[model samples]
Structures are given as structure tokens and as C-alpha cells.
Target: MADPKGFMTTPREEWPRRPVEERVRDWDEVYVPGALLPIISKQADRCMDCGVPFCHDACPLGNLIPEWNDLVSREDWRAASDRLHATNNFPEFTGRLCPAPCEAGCVLAINQPAVTIKNVECAIADRAWAEGFASPRPPERLSGRTVAVIGSGPTGLAAAQQLTRAGHTVAVYERDDRLGGLMRYGIPEFKMEKRHLERRLGQMRAEGTKFRTSVAVGRDLRAAELRARYDAVVIATGATAWRELSVPGRELDGIHQAMEYLPLSNRVCEGDLAESPMSAAGKHVVIVGGGDTGADCLGTALRERAASVTQLDIYAQPGAERDEDIEPWPTYPKIYRLSAAHEEARDLETAPSADADARLFAASTLRFTGDGSGHVRSLHLVEVDQARLPVPGTGRTLPADLVLLALGFSGPDREDGLIDQLGVATEPRGTISRDAGFATNVPGVFAAGDAARGQSLIVWAIAEGRAVAAAVDHYLTGSSRLPCPISPHDRPMTV
Candidate 1:
């Protein structure tokens, strides 16, 4: 155990972010660099180290939470990182991005604040890199099988790394000019710097994972030809077909999908452009959708110096604290929480009121009003109740020089002809159909991550990648050594 009475003695503390005024001025990571190194041990000690850790059950990747927590508390960073990497391929990505369902299931969270599992995990990963603990682990011998992974997101990266370390010849295909699908463009650099991604990709290259960017599998090369070239194929393409909000004046010029707007900002950071064409600068931006993506839009707009930012959600506002009666211990509760973006938004002078949040819960967009030139100028919305039926007498309009729909994704992209050409089947929900072993209907072709499971977290993507790698390894050699974190149908107690 980390500390016999550590949970009792220590108060939970998370890594502190840089001041809002300072952080909003630049695209650097939100944290004060090296801030956690001093206080992390005590935070790690807060783990109760439960006999039956529900943290494991809540994490789709089944991360070894207690082991790493203990190792961190002991200041055995190398060992802690090793234990972390044993199950996860990229703790850095998950550490920065994942919602940390494990903490929601923490035993201590039944009463007190949850153990700082996410912070500890991030510290370990950052330490591992700083100390040269994270390195290429090339296999000693070849497995004599070649596999192709489509997409360069977390799932494809994880599967490619696993297959490469397992001694299989792995080639990852991405449509973008550079690698790291969403990592390269979908995610903002302020949340996670690109250097972390570059570091891992460097390690993968040293370990013999071949990357082929700007090559569309179904267009640049047909799916059938790809199948013939490789012994097996894993489709790790993400659910990118974003859900739409069909309403009057949806065709306004200033309106765009969140993916469309966020990626451009990322490209500006990538030096592809000096400024984002879709920059929210000087605009009154209204983000529709109350999830993480909406918050992302909110933060990005604030950083871009938007005149104002407002986020709208159709669901009723969540409680500030967990309601155990509604969602018992060990299950992730939908409680109101402030994210870094929300924190930044709170300080904006343009906030609606002295006490009001930038977010408007239980609000539904009725339509948009466009300027004479057909650019959006205002958004019409109304408050709603639990049933989402709008409450009368609550209709309102707000200036919206720009509108971003962060409404989430629908399913995988089938327009590329990959699914059609491969003859793969899809579930009614539009996700690719996979068997118990993560295999698609087509022989020797498997699917994983959001491609098969719909839009989900990075943890699930890594788990899906690992599971699919195992199935591919078995299909190629009748038996395999790769670890399978979960079955195709497995579900974690996460949203």
C-alpha cells in the first residue's frame, strides 16, 4: 500500500492551471510546468487502494490504477511508468484528454473527493518521457505477418504500436498529409501540446511502425487491393460523421460544424496557416452543444479573442454534487463540473451576468437569423424542461456573429467506399458491425474504436485497439501474446 492511512491523512489536490489571464494569451498547455512534481506523492497517497478497485471496472482500458498510485507515492517513477504502460499505449493522451471515469469509481469518492488518479497518471507519463523511460521496444523476431491500420487517431496508433511490438509488419494509413489524425488537427494545442504526440510517434517509428499519410485507403488504393497486400486489416477510422441540428436558416454562411472550426485553429498552430480562416476573432460566437466539444469551442473562441461566447445545452442543468440515490457509488454520476475551458470562460467580461455561467442549460436553438448577406447574425432559442419540450415564455435571441455546432458525431465515414468495397456490415446505429472477436463480416478484416463503437473516449479506443490486435494476431498465427483489454461488446460504467 502507498500509505496505510494515506487516504485519511492526505487531502486531494489536483495540478493547478496557469492563471486565466496568462494561459489565454498563448497556446501552451494549461498547467504551470513542473507544478505537480512537488505535491504529486501526497496526492497519489490519497488512493485507498481498495481490495476490489472499482476504478478498474469503470475504465474501459482497465488501467492498473492502484499499482501506479503506489509506485508514484513511493517515488518510483520508472516503475510507475512501466506499470502504466503495461496496459495503456499512450497515458499522456489519456491523461490530458480522458474524463477519468476511474476517479468517479474511486472508493474514496463514495464520501470524499476521489483520488487524483488522472493527475498521477499524467505525472508518471511526463516523468517517463523526461527521464528517458519511454523508448522504442522493437520485437526480437518477426511474426511474418503484415497488417494495415486505417486512420491515425488513438485507436490506429495504439493498434499499430501493439502490432509492431508483437513483431508484425504494421502500416498505418491516414488521409491527412501528416500523422496523428485528431491528435494532429482535431484537438487544440492548449489542452495538450503537440510535442507529446511527436515524441510518441518518434518512438513508434524507431519500433518499425510504418506510417503512410495522405493515402486514402479506398481512393488512393482500393480496399480489395489493400486486403490482398496485407495478411490482415484493422479499420480504426473514427466516428467523424457529425450529428446535425436541422433548423431554419441552417445554411447561414457563418455556421459550421465543430470539427470544421476546431481543426482550422489547430492548423494555424501547426504552421500550415498564419491565421485560421474560421477564426472567431472579434465575433460573437455561440456554441450549440453542452459536452466537452462545446467547451472546447468556448475555450478556443475565448483564446481567439471572440467578442462574446455562449454555450447552449438542451438537457437540464446537472447538480453541483453527485446524487448517490440517482447514481450509486461505483457508477459514474452526471454531476456538474467546471472544465479548464469553463474556468477560462468564467472570467470573460462578456459573460451574460455577474452570477451566470457562459453555459445556458436546458436551452434549445429554434433557428438562426442571418444578415442581409446571408451570414448568421443572431441565434433564437428557448428554455426547456426535463422532457426537452420548450417552456413557454422563455424564448430569447442572442447576437451570434458565428455559430458552431459541437453536437457530437453520428458514426464512421462510409463515403470513402472502404466499407462498401469491403462488404462490411453496419449496426442500425451506423457503427461497423464486429463479431465477438472484433472481426468484421469480411474475412481477415477487423474493426475497432469509434469505427465500430461510435464516438467514445480515448481509453475505449486504446482498449479497442488492443483487443483488435489480439484478434488479428490470433487469426494470423492461431495463438497470440498480445493483451486483450475487453471484448467487442464490453461496456464500462462511463457516459
Candidate 2:
């Protein structure tokens, strides 16, 4: 238990964000540095530490929330960090990037605002780094078996770290010059600085987990050779084949996928380029899709000084409160959330004719009108009904110099040839097929994360990575001591 009456006495407060005017001018994170520590101890006290904490079920990683909350409330950073890292490999990434379904499942959320579980977790993680609580935990003895993990995203990194700590020789293969997949590129610096990622990579290196960059396993190194070299192979390559828009004039200049646009900005941050070639500076940017990816684009465009930015969502806007009948407690609900980017858009008034946010809910793109020089000039759209069918006479147009499709991804990219070369079974939805144990049909082959689960949250990816590591360890040896968080079929605690 965190505090006897803290839940009732203390109101919920979150990590404060920097002023919009200043943050949008730079690539630094949106949060006010050193602000969370001052308020986090009180927030942790608000945790009731219920008899059956649903936060564990809500989190795919099955983190010991109550234990860490108690530790944090007592200002015990070492114990809190140990408990936090017991299940999760990278709390820093999750604390920054994850949407925090754990808070929704909190017992306090039944009536009052939930304990700031996400903020508390982030504070604990940050304090751990500052207090030197995070250190390399290398294995005591070496195991003869070896493992090859493809992809360096959260999933791959988690699996590699677990197996390496279990005394197995592990090597992670990444195609890009950097280690992190989407985290290094698709995610913007405003949400989470890359230094957090770099720090964890350094720890993993010290723990003896090898990383191979700029090496596409299917092309640069044949899957056959890799399979023969390693005792087992784990395909943790995330779903990266992005969805497309087939609207009229989609091929016009200035039309690009979100991936193509986001990576350029990241490259500029990495010092690989002085400026992003696909920058949104002084342009009217229209982003299709209202998910987190679109919000990311919105923030990046704002930072790059876009003249105007608008986001389109096919689904209608949700209410502020949860519909208890449709979504009961402990289950994640669809609610209107004003993200940092949307707040910036509203406060700065960078959107054209937008209400509070730059989003146009229930609006569907119809076509693109181009100038005589073959560059996009404007976007045509129509309001849609619940069925997503266009409503009569609800057409409109908006200036659009750059059109970005952030419609999300379908499955793992096949162009890498990993799927074909390995001959792994795939589901109808294009995800790699795996058994309950996260094992593929092919012997000694395993699949996890987005590659097997389809595109999903960062928490789910890390959970799958830990579970797959346990399965791989058992296959290599007769038994294992690794903790398996979830099965392949296990899902979130939702109605």
C-alpha cells in the first residue's frame, strides 16, 4: 500500500509540459525537465494498491505496479527501479511512448481521476538513471547455445537482452544504420529524446548483447547461413508495410508516406543531414489518419514551420467520458484525448479553420487537386456517416502543398525476404503465423511482436519479446528459469 488515505486526499497531477511557444521551435521533448520529480512522490501515494490490481492485467508487460508504487512513495529509488525492471526491459521507452492503459484500469479511476501511474513510472525510471541504479546485469556463466534476433525494435531488444542475461550468446540484426526501428525514425524527438534509447543500447552492449547495423539479414546475410550459424532464430521484425490511400491524384508531387517523411527529420537529428529533404517548412500539410502517427506528423510539421496543418479522421470524435455500457471499467475506452501536438496546434492556431484541434473527425479524403506544374495544391474531402459513406452535400476543400498518409501499417515488410527465405507460415492478414508458445512451424524458429501480432503498441511488443525469449530458452535447454509474461493468444484485459 502506498498511503492510507492518499487516494482520497491527493488529486491527480501529471508531468507538466513546456510552453508551446518554446518547445515547437526545437526538437527537445515536450515535458518540462526536472518538473516531474517534485510531484511524483505525491502521485505515487495516490495508488490504493488494490487487492487485485487490474493495472497488471491492463499492461501487456505484467509490471508489478503496486510494489513499485509503494517503493516510490517511500522515496526508495533503488527498490522501485529493481521492481520496475523485474518485468520490463526498457521502462524509459514505455514510460515516454506508451499510451498508459494501466491508468484506465486503475481502481481509483472508477470515480476519481486515477493515480498518475504513467508519470510515477516515468519518474522512477528517470530517477533510477540519475542515481546509477540501472547497470549491466551480465550472466554468471556462458551457455553453449546461440540466438539470432532479427530487428532492433523494442521486441528484438527485449528478447536479445533476456537471452543474453540467460547466458546465451545473442546477436541482433538491424537493416537500418541505426538500431531502433521506428523509435529511431517514425517517433519524433518531441515525444521522447533519443538519448534515452542510446543509454539503454549502451547498457545492453555492456551486458554482451551484440548488435549488427546496416545488415539486412535476408539480403546481406542469407537466412540459411544465419539459421545454420545460430542454434535458433527469432523474427522480431515489426510490421512496417504501411497502408496506402488510393484516392484520385495520389501520385502527384508532395504526396508521400508518413515513413518516408518522418525518417528524413530523424536523420537530420542524427547529424546525418543538415536539413530534412522532405521538410514541411512553409507548406500547407494535410495528414490522413487521426492515430498517434498522424499526431507525430502534426508535431513535426509544426516544428518545421509548416504554414498550416490539418489531420483527417474517418471515425467520428468520441465523447470525453467513457460509455460504461459499451466499455466497462478496466477495459480501455475510446475517448477524445488532446495530445501535446493537438494542444500546440490549437494554441498556436496553425490549422486552417480548425475548431480547437487541427483534426477533422468523420471526414474522408475524396481527391487531390494539383497545380499545372504537377504539385498538389489542395485536398477535397467529404463528411461521412457512421457507415463511412459520404453524406450528401458535405463536400469541402483545403489547401494542401504536402499530403502525408499515416494510415498505419498492415504487416511486416516482405521486401526484406526474411519471410520467404525462412519459409515461415503467415496468416491471411499478412502477419507471421506462430503457435501458442510464440514458435513458428519451422523447427528452431520463433516469431514475436508486430511481426506475429500485427501492428500494435510498444508495450505489447516488449511483452511478446519477453515471452518468446522464455520459449526459446526452453527449446534450447530442457527447462528454463526465464519468466514468460504472456502467451501468444493472451490479450489485454478488455471486455
**TM-score against native, each model:** 0.98, 0.99
Q: What is the number of backbone collisions in each predicted candidate, taken in the order shown?
A: 0, 0
Q: Model 1 over residues 341-365: C-alpha lDDT tens digits?
A: 8888887665573124688888999
In model 1, where do residues sit more than 4 Å from their true spots? 353-356
How well is each residue in 293-399 modelled by candidate 2, as lDDT tens digits?
99999999999999999999999999999899999998998999999999999998888666449999999999998999999999999999999999999999999
Each model's lDDT comes to 0.91, 0.93
Scored against the true structure, residue 132 in model 1 reaches a CA lDDT of 93
Off by over 4 Å in 2: none
* Weakest 10 consecutive residues of candidate 2 by summed lDDT: 347-356
Clashing pairs in 1: none
